[model samples]
Target: MSSKIYSVITGTGIYLPKKKVKNEAFLDFKFFESNGKPVERPNEYIVDKFQEITTIQERRYVADDLVASDIGFFAAKKAIEDAAIDPETLDYIIVAHNFGDVKFGSNRSDMVPALAARVKHKLKIKNPDCVAYDVPFGCPGWLQGMIQADYFIKSGDAKKVLVIGAETISRVIDLHDRDSMIYADGAGATILEGKESSSPVGILTHKTRSDTYRYAEMLTMGCSYNVTEKNKNDLYLKMNGRRLYQYALETVPLSIKACLDKAGKDIMQVNKVLIHQANGKMDDAIIERLYKLYEIDEVPKGVMPMIISWIGNSSVATVPTLLDLILKGSVENQEIKPGDLVVFASVGAGMNINAAVYQF
Candidate 1:
């Protein structure tokens, strides 16, 4: 029998900015009236409500000198080192991002030179045949890139791929916007290489779904609505928390279960569930519902590890960062052993949801 070939994640890396913004920093944040009058909420009220909703205590922001691609290059270098692979041998470089790279202090997004191409240049990979591209699937873009790598390996079209998710979201967020508190800057990457194997040891199956018609506007980046703001032209992320909350509550759990079903695995077989670090409460609720779907009376502890409280949401970077942390034992008391089933899932701005089943 022909041996099975699998695209397995050989290594992972992450880059988080040096600056950390704590919840208290938002105490003086201004909320404007329709007339553009500055209205201030008490610090306690603001922090309490934010914690109650998103459960984020702090997040990171890029240094004044760096851009998203710069951050991603650092991560890519480390990922290549971890994988112990020469950059010249990479078959492809897939970069997933939302805002290409908002220049240090401006919202001017640079897209002419794609982030992947920039990283490839920065890595100094000499092979012109090493293809590089970007995927902008909102927050799930990184996972989508990894999924694409899996298919490439499966089709004999590629041998090794570098998948990266990086974002400098702080640049796109309005300083006065409440949603600003929920966004951060960071990057994560994984090196996937095709290898011949007898058993499934890599990406098994995945399910991706989108509902743009219904939730397209739920989370968006656009000009500030406040007429009082000096720069109405300034764009920032705006989200309808209630709508997104409802949508995630309804869609994510089922998407995960469906992915597991596609992989012909039971819920109990999954050792780690690395979900998008979007919201703490929402993630907890989703895990609970997933357990209920399997008719389990109690949710297992450590099944879902969350870093949102400290990292906030770095869009596409969340899952890979969290995965890298756990894989490297940076996360206390958590580790993924060989032969363990690891499930990766996320829901993002495209109103897109995706889940992939993998054997570690």
Candidate 2:
């Protein structure tokens, strides 16, 4: 094959909030079931059980004054700086976030200008051709934005693109719901440059699937589960945890295998798997199943780097954040060097799932 343009990640950054909400912080929380029945178990046991299953010890919450766009700008600035490129040279700013800038102490989401425009304004980029937009594909949103960036690069329509995954889920959670603790606020960004090479490099292959017909409601926004709450108008993020878990277990491995297959790469050749930090146990199961699909008996150690223990699930922000950390050598025992093959995968709200194969 002749030389071709590929979307290669040139720079990356992440913004994790300073407000560290530890598992103990929720001990005093009055958790309630969807049926309005209060969880009667002692909070100590509940916290321990949660920790055992999710492996989340603490998660970050953005400061009261900040929202999704603010943190996204923070990460975008770092990525632009890291790439050592002029801001005006950028071609696109794609922000993937579910709740659009939900302000602190307010349940309403402000989406008039779009998060990407707000980020662009903060960046002060003068390029009118630098198209900006928002993507809301659930947790897979960030990876999907990256897939779109790849297309722009390959089509020769753009030279550089900024893909950001940012979320302020804390502002939209029902405090009384136990699942509320699973959410955190964070942002991550990457600058992808179109590089022409004779051999395959940068993004290799990708696949995405949306099971909306039957699984659209797997995750949604709903009124507070607390029956005592009078604000029926304010809805928070809701999920069918059991069904979602099972759904991911059955699908994520297949998605990964499919993407790797498209890349003509074997599972054993992958150096790392950057998966969405949703549930620790579920991630383990998904990886295990992926190995089973290859007829392998053991998953390589350190193949998947996990941050959910401390960072929690920031929805679309998870995979990109994880990638940034690994690249920066911040993730313990996890590092990616040149010529390494890695997989980025995520599953979330739209009952959506996606995976991308990248070679550094």
Candidate 3:
């Protein structure tokens, strides 16, 4: 008898709004600039200070007519089509998002049924047992959703699971705020299918840690209850950039090493190191630290910096978007072995850090 293989991502798809916002375009906005000068953009100064940091170039945004659910639905359908799986086979759908469809009335979880209904109606699938809900875990939400789906599939309770991370950060962003400048809006999906094999090359090991005691490090709160005028600027995302960076640099490398160690693999065995496309400078520092800690002379150059110039940070959508970019020839000509490991590590707003090891 073969050991239960578990779940693996069979198909991946990403949907970026057709509209592309560039860094140069941001300079024209009065709020994005400093005293009518173009030096206010985060990338402008940060990239110059750090040679390794580059630009995002372009990022997608939802049309004024669209919302987060629309982006989520588009990515989900594409992923389902790519997997060649009927919607009826999808036993579960997990949406990872901090912002939901309705700002006040509906929670993130409420969007799930509507999304499932849309998929059902669009695909015309007759599966009656589909379960759908949202997992609101900030940036690490997508990986957490993946971990949950994996468990459900492994328990023989589900055959096919659709995991999606979608965000419309633009809606909540205080365009006048510098901290919100780095955020954009997008969505991506992955199909995790249950299988029976001896050695499944899917999600191998997962670990997460939280330091919520530092919750104030990044927060958004209201001073008044009135929604009309008093709360006009209450919905924006705020962060202590320096503090968040400290936590990430301190925690993520150890988490990555521990994840690899749990899988009984060495650092050299990993092919791609997919860290959250946070700040380009911070990412470079983390990579350098990792290399020095491991005593490795030559650090691998497959590290992808996805969120620097264009899209900013799309929160949970970052990783899947990075995956899509890699699959779509962004990282072409790179040699990747069959059993090579891929590392996904992220430190999010809740002071949460998570790392997952995958073999491809």
Find the candidate with the highest lDDT and give its number: 2
Question: What is candidate 2's lDDT per residue for 33-116, written digit by digit as tens?
Answer: 898889989889988998999999999999999999999999999999999999999999999999899988897988879999
Tens digits of per-residue lDDT for model 1, 1-360: 567998899989999898999999888777653345564666578678988889999999999999989999999999999999999999999999988978876887888699999999999998998999999998999999999999998999899999999999999877665667899999999999998988788999999998988788888876654654567777777788788988998999999999999999999999999999999999998888888899996887899998999999999999999999998988888899999999999998879999999998
Candidate 3 stretches greater than 4 Å from native: 28-58, 102-126, 221-233, 305-308, 332-337
* lDDT by candidate, in order shown: 0.90, 0.94, 0.72
lDDT of 2: 0.94
The segments of candidate 2 whose C-alpha lies over 4 angstroms from its true place after superposition are none
TM-score of 2: 0.99
Give per-residue CA lDDT, model 3, range 1-360, as digits (tens): 567766888888888877787655554343433233434446555433333333455456678777777788888888888899877889988888886763432222235555545545555666678877778788888888888888898788888999988888777664544455467788889999987778857888888887888554564532222233745445456566767777778878888888888888888777888777777778777877776778986676655444446666788888887876676566555443567678888878677788888877
CA lDDT of 181 in candidate 3? 49
Clashes of each: 0, 0, 2
Sort every candidate by TM-score, greatest first: 2, 1, 3
In candidate 1, the residue pairs with backbone N, CA or C atoms under 3 Å apart (3 or more residues apart, or in different chains) clash, namely none
